[model samples]
Target: MENKKANKLIDKILENLDKTGINTETLIDDIKELRTYALEEQIPLVVKVLRYTYEHIEENNSFLIPTLDDEPLDEEGDVIEEEADSPVESLKYLLSLIKNLKNKVNISDLKEYRDLLKAY
Candidate 1:
């Protein structure tokens, strides 16, 4: 049955996790990545087990799904929180912030630029 297959997938994931001593934070991040991969790969039960783990095991206090209350605040501390932002504006803001940071630190070398890129 479909339920048995789902349970087997969940068991396999747990067994794999048990074989390593990954820290909780890293494990959470890895699981999230796995969920995304499963969704992209069209694995139905893999997605279900991930959802269950995120909902019941993860300490995020809420399930993996975003709730209505998850929103961004405005200058006046109000949540306008549109569904998405313009990619161009996002990249511009990020570049401006990096430029300001680089100017503040006087970091012009390629190594420092790479480090800053990784930091953000």
Candidate 2:
């Protein structure tokens, strides 16, 4: 049952893309704003956001998700922060990520802030 619905949704999305001249990059950038905002009890808000952004995405046309990877880990569970491009911006990105993931798990390297410092 779900597969049928999933296929329909996928087909509809593909149909819309074909009808509209939207490409992969357009979809990516359009949906990027939704990368932030932790999932909470606000199910309706989430749905509304997805709908609003996806429907009116082109007008917004900016803001990437600040998603980051966990810092490398050693056998001893130590974090190995790596230097990312544009240290200051990277640091800010990590800081925001840390704020979100702090309660969930121990992100020791703070998304590689220390590694970025060493490179600086």
Candidate 3:
């Protein structure tokens, strides 16, 4: 079943998160597979996040990790440049977002958006 397949993929992803070094290519492939499930399930938020994350990683070769502060100063008082997240950190962050997605998105709102798109 699709649910079983999705669960297997999620388990794989979670396992990878615990490893010392993550294989990004495999992770990306897993994400793509999961995105298909999201599309079939009509979970717009998951679909969008997965698509955007995939495109971003593919196009930029890096994940967009936001900095905690707009301008961070060291003890010397000079502004510190923000550092990019490692692939593993990026994966973890993505997983967290996906896990909390239900709380953040309303299914009714997504349905309304879909309806609006159909009207156009």
Candidate 4:
């Protein structure tokens, strides 16, 4: 029951968006179902999405920056590559995304990811 409700709610949220116009009406019913389930279940649906968003953000932010190369660029013009994503900066970006979503997620929610980034 909870799964069905959650699925419906998530569907509704997706459907109501302009990007989801194709299945708009279908999602509407699911969204209503999800809302009822959320109210009865006392589950924070946004929290789950927030967690996923944060993880995805962290992955996207982890990239190679071509600055720490041991040798200068050759005739090909390829620079040295070094890992990017400074921990503090990454955390800031994650916080910004969460802020942009108008959702409140505490730093502790991403503590493990932050710690891993810090190690980098």
Winner by TM-score? 3
TM-scores of the models, in the order given = 0.31, 0.28, 0.57, 0.25
> Order of all candidates by TM-score, from best down to worst?
3, 1, 2, 4
lDDT of 1 by residue, 32-120 (tens): 66566557767554455445544343554322222112377889999885765432232223222222222533223323423333333
Candidate 3 stretches greater than 4 Å from native: 1-4, 20-22, 67-85, 105-120
Candidate order by lDDT, highest to lowest?
A: 3, 1, 4, 2
How do the residues 18-70 of candidate 4 rate in per-residue lDDT, one tens digit apiece? 35332424433443444455456554543443344334434554221111213
RMSD of each: 17.4, 11.8, 8.1, 13.8
Residues forming the 10-long window of minimal summed lDDT in candidate 3: 111-120
Alpha-carbon local distance difference test for all models: 0.41, 0.39, 0.60, 0.40
> Please, what are the lDDT tens digits per residue for candidate 2 over residues 5-34?
333433444454546544446554433333
- Lowest lDDT block of 10, candidate 4: 61-70
Better of 1 and 2 by lDDT: 1
Model 2 accuracy (lDDT, Cα): 0.39
Q: What would you estimate as the lDDT of candidate 1?
A: 0.41
Q: Name the TM-score of candidate 2.
A: 0.28
Candidate 1, position 99, lDDT: 25
In angstroms, the error of model 1 at 52 is 1.2
